[model samples]
Target: MLAMNYRGPYRVRAETMPDPVIEHPNDAIVKVLRSCICGSDLHLYHGLVPDTRVGTTFGHEFVGEVIEVGSTVQNLKLGDRVIVPFNVFCGTCYFCQRELYGNCHNTNPQATAVGGIYGYSHTAGGYAGGQAQFVRVPFADVGPTKIPDELLLEDAVMLTDAFPTGYQAAEMGDIREGDTVVVFGAGPVGIFAAKSAWLMGAGRVIVVDHVEYRLEFVRGFAQCETVDFKSVKDMALHIKKMTDWLGADVCIDCVGCEAAGSALQHLTGVKLKLQGGSATALHWAINSVRKGGNVSIVGVYGPTFNAVPIGNAVNKGLTLRMNQASVKRHLPRLIEHIQAGRIEPHRVISHVMPLEEVADAYHLFSSKLDGCIKTVLIPPGVTA
Candidate 1:
């Protein structure tokens, strides 16, 4: 099988690797039909996430056909096309019972935080992702949902991670009807967050980003206002001004560790490895929301400490909520939304490249070239 092989920071290429086989009783081998390059994958690509070993594949959003299944894998069988959630979890655990699949205790039990994630890194249970011709799916019965016949494979793939994460970001905000919500970052996740805010009855949705193309894309896609943070002197102040000086009712940080804009933050966190990725977006979120409003975070950050504004948050009495999206928990409702045409997840896709050219796809996406918003990789023989 050909897989995206991670060599080092800024280095990845398609290389022939051994085909995956069922390793556990609940495991299944999937022939990947469609996979994606998520914004979160960039963290591993840039070596910001810890313990991302060389030779590991990096992809979490994918939909595939079950080629084989183990003895205990009763939910899936050969020829079943499924959307595999990014979370690799045991459905019966305490956290999973509460519908917090991202924090499942049985998977990645060694860690005190985050559960198993496909192709993230050793810190995320060292599971191989689906950025290849095939992938091994553990706890197959719990995580892989059959793709609805009415759903496009491209749309179903986004539900595996980005769409769910974005939707979860909005849900965590607890947006009241007519509340003004400002989303920081215009990536796929941010765009979805902005879109979800509207579905939840937000009166106003604004996306903040330094990239003009992304701003333009989100503005058109989500039908919301956009802010180019690079054009503003103080992001927080600008957001406050936009909200009539009281600040937005809700602020979301969709930009994580790699956020640009702060020289000191980049120098200390990204360059010096002194703290977990830059907290620039987080800083903007904490200071840009109304005093008693909510701040929702769906961005990926390192496990280490960040230079966050705890004092400001405490002083303002903000409700800060964050966690990896429990993709399994959001699947059913999201599927209904997609089937009903409430959201078109595939519209976010800007490029579709063959899996063999994954190296080029990574470069194009990470560099933000060719007006790329989302790139989906199709395996060699599979036509999607």
Candidate 2:
């Protein structure tokens, strides 16, 4: 099997690796038909996430056909087309029983925070991802959902991570009808969050980003306003002005550790490794929401401490909610949204490349080249 190999920072290649076999009674082997290079994958590509081993593959969003299943995997079988959630978990655990699949206690029990994440890093259970011809899915019964026959492979793949994540971000915001919601970042997650805000009855939705193409794309896709943060002198102040000086009713931080706009944050967090990725977007979120408003975070950040505006949040009485998207929990409702044409997840895909060019795909997405919003990688023999 050919898989994306992580060599070092800013380096990756397609290399032949041993095919995965069922290792646990609940395990299954999947022949990947479609895989995605998520925005969070750039953290590993840029050597930000801790303990990302050199030989590990990096991908979490994927849809595949089950080729084999273990003895205990009764929910799935050979020839089943499924979309595997990014989380690997045992469904009977305390957290899983409560529908908090991302924090399942049985998987990655060594960590105090975050559960098993496919292809993230050692900190995320060290599970191999689906950025290859095949992948091993653990706790298969609880995670993989059968893809609806009417759903496109592209949209089905997004359900594995991006769509659910974005929806969760907005869901956490607790947006009230007629409230003004502001989203930070215009990546696929942010775009989805902005769109979800509308579905949640938000009167106004504004997406913020430094990239013109992304800002333009989200404005159309989400049917909301956009702000190019690079053009503003002070992001928080600009957002306040947009909201009539009282600030937005809700603010979302979709941009995590790698956020720009702060020289000090970039220098100390990103370049010096002094803190978990930059907190620029978080700072804006804390400072730009109205008093007593909500701040929802779906952005991926390191486990280490970040220089955030905790004081401002406390003083303003803001409700700050954040967590990895419980992809399994949101799957059923999101499937309905997709099937009804309420949201077109595949429209976010700007590029589709062959899995053989995984290296180039990484560079293109990380560099934000070619107006790339989302890139889906198709395995060598698979057709998009």
Candidate 3:
């Protein structure tokens, strides 16, 4: 088997690796049909995430078929088309009982510190992720979901991460019907955040990103307004003026640290603040919200501390909820939406390449070249 390995900063290669097997009773193995290149995966490539191996399998978003199952896996079966949740978690843990599946204590080795994530880092579960032909899945009954045959693989691919994550950010942020919502970062997650804001019944969904292509892509969705942050110094005022000075009711930050291209923009200086204030999407979202509005953040962060504006949050009586997706809780509902064709998350994908060309795809996605909004790496023989 060949896997994309994180060799060092800005270095990743498609390298041959041993095949994975079920190491636990709750484990299942899926033959990856379509995997993705995520913004967070760039963290591993850049060597920003600590404890990850130089050559750990490196992707988190995917859809695939269940080729094998474990003793405890009752609900899932062989030949089932499924979406692999980015996180590997035991269903019966203390945090799992509270629906915080990402923080599950049993599966992840670093469970004492935080939740475990696939293809994320050693700090997570260190589970080899789905950036290749086959991936080991833990807690299959609770982890993977079977999709309808009528639904496309690409549709299910999104459920694994971006789509649900974008929606989860808004859900945790307390987005409501007819409320004005502003989402920062028009990247994949940001676009999903904007779509979820509208689906959750936000009166107006406003998106912020400097990329012309991304903001333009958001236009296909109904009832959306967008802003290029590079054009505005005072983002809050810009949003307020667009909203007739009413401000938004909820704001979501989906960009995390890597906005536009790389989170280490200041360190890399390659793009020169590629997305500008998008680096502080949270700060802008908090400022753009109405006095009592809610702010939700869903971007993946490095294991470090950065100064957040507590003063404004305290003074305005803002409600804040920020974290990774509770995939167990969010996945089922998203699956239903997919079955009904209420939303087509696949619209965000701009390219689909064969699995063998994984290395080329990564370079394009990292460089943000060729108008690459999203790229899905299909298995070599995947038939259209």
How many steric overlaps are in each model, in order? 0, 0, 0
Q: Is candidate 2 or candidate 3 better by TM-score?
A: 2
lDDT of 3 at 330: 89
Cα lDDT tens digits, model 3, 1-384, are: 867777777777777888889988888898889899988887666555668787788788988889888888899889998888887777888988898888888877664745778888788878888888888888888888788778888888888888888888878778767888888887788888888777777887888888788888887753488788888878889888887786788888887765543256444422332332234677787888888889888876665554467899999999998877877688778878877777888888899887777778888887878889999887655664
Q: Which stretches of candidate 3 lie over 4 Å from their true place?
A: 111-113, 260-279
Q: Please state every model's RMSD to the true fold in angstroms.
A: 0.8, 0.8, 3.1
State the local distance difference test value for candidate 3. Answer: 0.79
Q: Itemize residue pairs with steric clashes in candidate 1.
A: none
lDDT of 2 by residue, 1-384 (tens): 999999999999999999999898999999999999999999999989999999999899999999999998899979999999999888998899999989999899659778899999999999999899999999888899999899999999999999899999999999999999999999999999999999899999999898999988998899999888878898878988898899999999999999994688888888888889898899999999999999999888887889888999999999999999999899899999888889999999999999899999999999999999999999888877
Which pairs in model 3 have colliding backbones? none
